[model samples]
Target: MAEFPRTDVFSGPKKTIKTPAWEPGYIRDSKSGKPREIPIIKQLYDVLMKLPRDTEKVFTVPKITLVRYFQKALEGANIQDFRFHDLRHTFASHFIMKTRDLPALQKILGHYSPVMTQRYAHLTNGHIRAEMEILSAVWTPIWTPSEKSVPCEVQKSFVK
Candidate 1:
């Protein structure tokens, strides 16, 4: 297996976000009672790699702060009725559509169960339909192949 670089990010200090005390090792994943390993994308890794050596935390911001920034970007893009959480939804939808790997996506998204990730399955249905249409266009249909005297096993394996 190829080695992948890891970025150690200190999510927050020894404190709770609700009442914020000296509670250690608590991040958003603590709510789910499980630790999650989120993958570092190339662009994020490149940007994070630029942080100074003395930096301990990768990013430290409240949800409201993130929402404020997201809203600004939304205004610039002329997008409406979009929340900060919608970004996560959009990413999940697209990831499922591209990879068609739900289990991997579930892990990436830090869902407790695969069922939690099923909401994105509907989005993938459209992708599957589009892919099937492409297959129909590129290769002849089953009826056409059968009429052309194609072998059943070969047709079932590749053409179908």
Candidate 2:
């Protein structure tokens, strides 16, 4: 299902996209029954601030027009073979990597169940190594022959 952002706001930095479009599609998620509110981070807030509040919508242009320009932007930046949906995926992936918070991402992506948002999870390739690092010091072996031996008191405990 496609969602359109709601421009009407009385106060606060939250924005919502409502699903179940007038056009039909496959069942998305049970959690997607209601609109999802996204908190505005500094980058988004800055862009919103720059946009003219004179209009109701943050974007004055039509969705197609914006997509066309976004394509042009991709071309300018030498980004190839990417669609608007790819951008959403990229954003979701990065957000999950940075936050490691699945529920938060589910809310942001408007997924009713985290299972949908899990599709966006591309944890760092080093995730395993990063976790294994905690055990590195523990397994170092205090008395490896090449390294100094432990103090006599420490060594005696091991010897016993």
* Model 1 regions lying over 4 Å from their true place: 1-33, 51-55, 121-129, 134-160
TM-score of 1: 0.59
> In candidate 1, where is summed lDDT lowest over 10 consecutive residues?
19-28
**Model 2 Cα lDDT, one tens digit per residue, 17-126:** 54322212222333335643555566665555566544444457888999999999999999898898887788887887677788888877777788888887766668
Off by over 4 Å in 2: 1-33, 126-128, 134-160
The top-ranked prediction according to TM-score is: 2
Model 1: number of backbone collisions: 0
For each candidate, give its TM-score against the true structure.
Answer: 0.59, 0.59
Task: Please give the TM-score that candidate 2 achieves against the real structure.
Answer: 0.59
lDDT of 1 by residue, 30-62 (tens): 346565556666666666555554323445566
